[model samples]
Target chain A: MTVQDVYLLSPEISLVGLALLVMAMDLFVKRKAVLFLMAVVGLALPVALSVMLWMDVQAEPGGRLVGVYGALTVDKFALFFKFLVLGSAALLLAASLDYAKRLTRLQGEFVGLILLSATGMTLLAAATELISIYVSLELTALPLIAMCAFLGSSRSGEAGLKFLILSGLSSALLLYGMTLVYGFTGSTYLTEIGEAMKNPLDPSVPFGGLVILVGVVLMVAGFGFKISSVPFQMWVPDVYQGAPTPVVAFLSVASKAAGFAVLLRVFYVAFPSLEMDWALLFAVLAAISMTFGNLVAMVQTNVKRLLGYSSIAHAGYLMVGLAAVASRIPNGGETSALGSLLFYLGAYTVTNLAAFFAIIGIANKIGGHKIDDFAGMAKRSPLLAAGLTVALVSLIGIPPTGLFIGKIFLFSAAVESDLAWLAVVGVVNSVVSAYYYLKVARLMYMAEPASDEETPASSISLRLALIVSALAVVAVGVAPRILTWATDAAASPLLP
Target chain B: MDLEKFLILSAVLFCIGIYGVLARRNAITVFMSLELMFTAVTLAAVAMSRYVASRQVLANPGDASEAVLQTLLTGQVFALFIIVVAAAEIALGLGIVIAFYRSRETVDISQANLMSR
Candidate 1:
């Protein structure tokens, strides 16, 4: 309501307005260039503004400005994720250009939804109260469902429907949990709930504390569905394979990253007192997700489905960091574990983007995404193959790759938290995951050129995307200290 | 009913909603199940607000006049948000279902499998 609050939330406000503006402009403009330009500008402006705010914040920390009854809080944590979300939108928009022209209809609306969803993600991260988080979460989810069917094709339509129904179910489950928490605590504000739970009403009858614990589990299950955690991850492969490549890329990175941002805030900020109750459940979920995803991925022939399972496995690895940080048998605190989660998310984002960039380039060229179809990828285009090599190596957590560094930090955190069993499970899963990721690499490198006619060459934009993402992966892998420091700084005072 | 009983009833309603959602194949039935879940949440919120009001009344015996206002406002707010979310969900959900029906001539979820590789 105040000027300070307006300043704090201007990035999100502008993003929403820009989304509407882009949608309106679509009605007037016929040129694809215009739509792309508008989207780029929309995403770029917010990212730049947020980055400037981040820098200014580092120079002189800003006061936490609450908007509308402590519903949303704009602080360092919010700004960090706002930058990341908007930056992701920019990258996704840039990556969408050629693919959108070829595959999808309603190009303008697709771009608009990207911006809108990023805005929603920003708010979801900033939200301090339960209702605001729920609203923002829906805002993020709605557009994502729409985007999955941007092609307006039957297959895409089915994917969209699947995502819509599954997402709605998850939202309802999460809301029910939130309602239970609110009922027990007499307030929807996380701070209030924490204060209320500082002294639990009763240890018996599954009273206030137990009800809240069940609520938290439901919330995790809901988010687990979004992040494609095992048992709740049935929709991922079908949706990813059915959707267009660019949309799949966007969903894999942006949606997953946003999910983590919210998860970190909820577990670290809102539910720190209840860490013990959630840790064991997450550890089990993590183990299942890693093992299940890797095993499923090994059998997948479709590139998108392979990546889908790989993403689920990646979620499991991230959950290892979550469980470690939230572990109750903690000797000291698990700030290092919290830092590892951030580090892994960053590494995963870059490596996954690189992999997708390569896949998109290949898909764009050959008009197919099956593993066997990539038999002569190295002979056809050495550059694209090289990019895939980097991405695949990183994905398999090979030495001198971003994922390798990420796994090291995560495992170290687990060791520090006395989660030796969980760490061992993660390592075993990582080793099993290598086989599937290597299969793609082997097909590209060792398989003979197919007898069929040559596929088309990679597009210039896609090639550029491949190069950019590959370099980023390698750069992060080589000089991980910069990312390490940032993650550590971001994760200060672990239990928010 | 007492606060505990009302809360238990809301929880039962929630479980019924879950069962319906899982067991039903019709899109409309699934939609109704979702609505049932929302209704359960509303009931829980209202009951909790009422309980808080009663506690406030007991704490400040002379200030029972504002208790009704507090409970009603909180419960109504919770209901209002839930309604908004439900409205948004229905708009999108039905849009997809109707669009699919136009193409496929069916509303059964089991028949909605066009995304297989």
Candidate 2:
């Protein structure tokens, strides 16, 4: 690797250094909250470096800088996800001050592991080669495994163990798929794999593309686990219900974002030759995932587990956009499906973070996450109740919300690509989803408080994070021009 | 022999690993099954590396460039990385399993159901 490569990797490298610095600082610092503060502040360096790289990509000829002999690509696509991951990490850390402080003995380690995981996410968004992708993906997951069980409770232990085994199984599945791809193509570089797949290898079984078909399917199943789509979503609610609230927030948003980032990159870069079949595959999976997630979520009493199912449903909605890609704007000259996907990811991140922070704040005082516990929250704590209400509204895709606009673009793209039935499924799912999302809002506003005592106000950090994210939801809803431009630019490197 | 033989063996081993994961009750045993899946992939990678390298060298006997050599070694390098990642996964998996055992006194997958309700 050259100096150029290292320069391109400054955001990831500096983030790793910051993670290590947080752990090392634990040795000298007595105040653990300071470590959390330091972690949030340390993120500025990576954010600045990524912004510089974004400018660099904009000026470059192909809107990308292929570094480390093409194992890593510094493009607007990678930079956009990097910024999102970093932004989520900062907000999560800042907001989790109360929840994280409860881990008195392991606070430093808690913050440290989060930083390391964020570093993995940043690298994951940029990794272009299969081997790099594999290594970076592990880096992204291992810390999360530890974090899932970081509380050391019985349920947390169960969550961690289940996550560990399932994660190992999924990676093994993905690796075997990669092995087949490598064997058939004689290369692991994506462009070369795409070239090799132009004429598939064996013509004996599975419609003359047996090897690539099995490979692609296995890889999809593996990534399906990461993105928490249906049939592979069993671990999500369990882990979400058991893991620390902060970590769950990270898993639901940043981890899912990274998973989609890699999925988009791999499909766009490596499998350009295969067409329409996987689109149908994703569309079918999308339908089942949303239907199943919404159905099961309706019965969940635990707020964490309920939102976990909601995340699965959102994953399905996003897949509608993923499957809507039939060509490069064949009809009207409008936004690409991928741009819509990225925009949805950005909107979902802030919206979910707002809701998770509200829960974290309320749960800190109540010590339980039951939907029943949030009854009369509007009177108990007006700020948190309002924040959560806004989030739930956006999640249901109501007007004047970011998800409303996101769903419009995604469904339109689906209709444009001859997948109007899928768009209908998405709309019907969204309407069905409103039943559960609005349930919480109604409970908070209508139900009587269980006690005369008011829950004390949220910590200053939590309050700030909650308010900022809630406003961000409306910002994206109202003036999405800048976000749309960024998403369009991010999508260009992958499209014609 | 051709590359197909090795691929078939790897596929069988992988299927066995999947069976073990589904059938095993103990968490550690399930984790062991996961290790088997990784091992099968490792074997597939190494086998493919050998077969593909020989095929490429035969196809162009003396035209060896750095990029061509790197492409030929992708399989072997991938195998190496898989082994390393599997080791790390096992280390963390065992750590969590031990953590599980401390609380529940057993690593049976079925019994760990505090969150089911």
Candidate 3:
């Protein structure tokens, strides 16, 4: 609204500008590749702006900058996600270049939509007000629903329809919850809600405790769909299987990360007074999600659907960290639990991106997403096969992989918070997940090729994306100090 | 007349909407159901705002009335946002339904199960 507010929102503004520029350039540019390249290069502006904001936060005494009348905050936490979302956008654009050729007409719109969604995601991370958070969430999801339908194929249309209906349903539930919270607190500001919730009982409202509890439960259900956790995870496999591979990759990583971002902010900032109640809720959800996702994933034949289930399982793992943070709040252990969650999100981003990039490369050549299609991939394209293998290993929590360190931190946090039973369930689920993840690896390495034709080589951009993400997985796995330190810094914003 | 009566009406509409969403086969019908849910939410928000405003006016008559009115507007503002967002959601939903019908020749969600195992 003011000059200073605009200054604080430079990164989001630049991202929107970049999205529009990509759309406009599509009209004049002869080659669609140029538009793709323009979008990719323009992502640097937001990344640079985020870095500047990061430095600004570091220099500030409290390491937080509230702007737009407390609707948005620029801190290490939001900056971390800005970098992650921007990085993922750049990588996805690079990986989608060859795939965009298949779309023929909507290549420019595809890139434009991705950037627009990234803009929503960055804003979602920074939004501190309830209304701002809800708007940013819709902004993030609407483009994605459109993109899911961009393929115009029957399956794509189905994916799009399902995504729209389910997303709308969740939004309605979320809005009802927000309205109830506002009714109870008489304010829409998260800080004010927190203040009001300290002693939620009031003589004016009968059954005040039960009303707030219902509101909180409904809100969690809405977020549960976003993160693709159990009971609300029915759409994940269907959407992932039917949507374009690149969109699935982006959705699996960036969408889930943004979901968690807002989840952390809303729960920690607005409803900490109800920590014990929600902690038990998340613990139960986490146990169910991990068990259900891993068990069902073992039966999936399609690689994308399998990964979809695996993502649900991963969401459950992250919820373990959430439960830990809640239970440990009184002991001042929330910081470590939250830091572990952030670190896990970062590690999962790179690892999952690596896996999807490998899938994109192979599916581009073979034109199938079946596990049978991946047979003998190791012989055809050693680099892609190895990249996927490493990623799957990381997903299984094997040593020298990023997710291994992530799981360690998360489980330790759970145990430290006296949720060792949840930690045990998480460990058992990891073991169960390895059955399917390793099955894919075995298919790639051990099985004979279904045909004698040599698979075509992957495009250069995809190759670069795979190598970068794969190397990042290993680098972060071996040297987790840098990421942990950054996550620790990001987690500080949540501390009172 | 009373806040509880309005809230009960809103809750009934919301339950009916949920039933329609879960049981309807047609995508368009399901979308209508979603809109019904949003409308219910909007009703609840407005009723709550009015209820809070009446309480404020009774508790403090004159000097604090302006501040109470401003606070009451929060719920109304939230309802406005829900309306706008619901409009956008329905527009997008209809578009996706049309697109689905074009390819599948059906708006029945059960028939759209092409990706299920």
A290-391: candidate 1 lDDT, tens digit per residue: 998899899898999899989999889999988887783235466677778888888888788888878777777677888898887888878888998899
Write model 1 residue lDDT over B12-42, tens digit each, in one string: 9989988987888887788788888888888
lDDT of 1 at A271: 70
**lDDT at residue B37 of model 3 (Cα atoms):** 97
Q: What TM-score does chain B alone reach in each candidate, compared with the true chain B?
A: 0.82, 0.93, 0.93
Using lDDT, give the best candidate's number: 3
Q: Hey, what RMSD does candidate 1 come out at?
A: 2.8
What's the C-alpha lDDT at position A252 in model 2?
93
What's the distance in Å from true for residue A277, model 3? 2.7
How would the docking of model 1 be graded? medium
- Would you list the rank order by lDDT, best first? 3, 2, 1
lDDT of 2 at A136: 90
| lDDT of candidate 3 over A1-496, digit per residue (tens) | 9987998999999999999988998998889989878888888888998888888899998889998877888889999999999999999999888888888889999999999999999999999887898899999999999999989999999999999989988988888888788777777778878888887477768447776777877888888888999889999999999999999999999999999999998887888877456677789999999999999999999999999999999999999999998887765758889999999999999999999999999898789898878998888888999999999999999999999999999999999888999999999999999999999899889998777686567788889999999999999999999698899999997644
| Interface CA RMSD of each prediction in angstroms | 2.2, 2.1, 1.0
Candidate 3 per-residue lDDT over residues B1-117, each given as its tens digit: 877788778889988999999899999889999999999999989988887777767777775656566776877887898899889889988899999999989999999889959
List where candidate 1 sits over 4 angstroms from the true fold: A59-65, A202-208, A275-277, A328-332, A451-459, A493-496, B56-72, B115-117
